[model samples]
Target: MSCWDTIADYGLRSLGYGERLLPRSDFTLCQQVVLIGSGMLWNIYFGTLALIAGFVMATAVAMGKAARNPVIAKISAWFIFIFRGSPLFIQFFFAYFLFLSLKNAVPFFTVLTSAWAGALVVLFLNTAAYSGEIFYGALQSVPKGEAEAADAYGFGGWKKFRKITWPTMLRLAWPAYTNEAIFLFHATTLVFFSGFPAQSQRGDALYYANYFADKTFNPFVPYPVLAGYFILLTLVIIGLFGLINRRLNRHLPQERRSRMQMRMPVLR
Candidate 1:
């Protein structure tokens, strides 16, 4: 079959619409790309939803930690520290079990049993903690000069923060936020590995890729396919973030604004 045919036959296989079963024999490059690309839908679903949800929560946590009150600040600080300090793998496992146990106390909350809900929740919190720290750091690093300028313009409290502090934090943290986003996309692979089972084998890209490798006993094909897909996804993310960073910096003279740069995340 042509690559297009393979894709047409299996592109929506994860949702069980095309081909009742995945290709069991005669694996071709077309089949690998089609199947893995199909599986990427789930990864994108999780990553995109979690990212949108996480950013709002992250900003709140960062602002809370940056607050003047010691009580709220300390709690937010501990939250960021603990989540950032722990391995995401462990967090997934722990979250899955905690959700499982929740069945006893709240049987109606069955959403926790599914990867869509359970995994997304964990991912949201995980990204929030990481992003929270980045925002907090940016908050601290917001220049005193900006605040002084805002004061001269009679912008104080809510006005000062709205006009300056928030935007500056976003700009400073954009690069790190990009890294967080890339890692979160990659991290979606761990959903099936953790306690949340892949119902009907409807798994993420890594999950199906692993399936193909094990069935054929050839890691070379499926693994590289996954890596390529993820790399491409990362590039798309880079471009999107770059666009946003440019818009964020649009107000400044070209020299005064920092250039957006990519850095490999050491933590991940």
Candidate 2:
């Protein structure tokens, strides 16, 4: 096939369109790019959904962790500790088996064996834990003076939190939150590697990249393409977050607004 024909055939292959079987031998640059790019759809879906859903839960979790009630605080702390203290790779395995065990009793959980449901849930919970910790620290760091001022005007309870607390916490947490988001996107690469089945080879960017590498016995080509795709994805994330960061700090003077920087997670 010509380059354009190859692109047309495999462009959306990851979504089960156009090409049915992947190139088995004599891989070309066009095949590598098209197939890998198609695979990116899963990564984007996993990351975007997890981040959106995780943000809401993370906010609640942060509040719970910061609550005056010791029981609430302990529950939140335990959740965070369990998810964060262990590696996410382990979480996927444990969660999959946990779901498997529950599936016999709760048939609804049978779907968890698939990367779509199970891996997404794991990523959602994992990101929520990481982002929750960031939000919790920001919540605690909310200026006491802001609280006192709200109190002077009789703001308290939900009123004080809604009007005076949440926005400030978001503004403060956003930078680190952005970092967490980038890391979470990077983490999506790990999903197929976990116990969850990719099912028909429909997988994320790294999955197809790995497939090509294995088939061609040439890591140099496919891996760099994968890396380039991720770099672009990272830049897109930074741009989107930069817009939000701008809005978060809109009220502050330019000098006071924090600049957004793309940072990689520190691996141990």
Candidate 3:
């Protein structure tokens, strides 16, 4: 089939649209590109939803960690430690089984056994813990002068936090948070390796890439294509986050604004 035909046939195969059967032989470059690109939809789905939901949870957890109540603080601290301290791969394995057990016990959890729901939960919690720590650090680092200034203006409680503390904390945490966002997107690939199965042959970009690699016994082509897709995704994330970072620092002089520098963690 022509490239356009390949696109039409496999463009959304990962979402269970178009052709159901994967190409078995005489694999063309167009097929690999299109199918893998199709699978990227899942990665984007997992990353986008997880990151958005995780942000809200992270903010709350950060506040909890920094709360005056020792009970709240310790609970938040343990939550972060449990998620952050463990390898994500292990988390996925255990979560799948746990959800599977729950599904058997409670029909309501049936959906949670699927990769779409189960894997998303894992990613959500993982990112939240990491980001909660980042936000907590930023909260702690919020200049004491800022708090004093808020007190001087008679800004207290939620109002003060909304107008003064929260915005400043975000401004301080955004650079690190951007990196976390990038890493979260990258981590979506792990879903393919998780215990959660891709139902109906619908899987992520890495899934299709691995298929092509196994079929052709040529790892070079499909793997590099997968990498290329992720590289483009990383660029998009950086550009978007950079705009937000700039918005956060807009009130400050250009030289005084905190610039976002990409720092890949040596180990997660």
Best by lDDT: 3
Task: Tell me the tens digit of each residue's lDDT in model 2 across 100-215.
Answer: 89999988998887788899999999999999999999999999999999999998899998989999999988888888988999999999898887778888899999999999
* Candidate 2 lDDT trough over 10 residues, lowest sum: 259-268
**What's the best-to-worst order under TM-score?**
3, 2, 1
Instruction: Please give the lDDT score at residue 227 for candidate 3.
Output: 95
Residue 226 of model 2 has an lDDT of: 93
TM-score of 3: 0.98
Write down the lDDT that model 2 would get: 0.90
Please, what's the RMSD in Å of model 1?
A: 1.5
In candidate 2, which residue ranges exceed 4 Å CA deviation?
261-268
- The runs of at least 3 residues in candidate 3 whose Cα sits more than 4 Å from the true structure, single-residue gaps closed, are none
lDDT of 1 at 13: 84
Candidate of highest TM-score:
3
lDDT of each: 0.88, 0.90, 0.93
lDDT of 3 by residue, 1-268 (tens): 6899999999999989999899999999999999999999999999999999999999999999999999999999999999999999999999999998988889989998899999999999999999999999999999999999999999999999999999999998987888898889889999978899988889999999999999999999999999999999999999999999899889998898867877755436
Model 1, span 1-268: residue lDDT tens: 7887787888988766777777889989888888888889999999999999999999999999998999999999999988898888898888888877887899965788788898898899989998999899999999999889999988888888887999999998899899999998989988888888888777888888999999999999999999999999999999999999999999999898778777666646
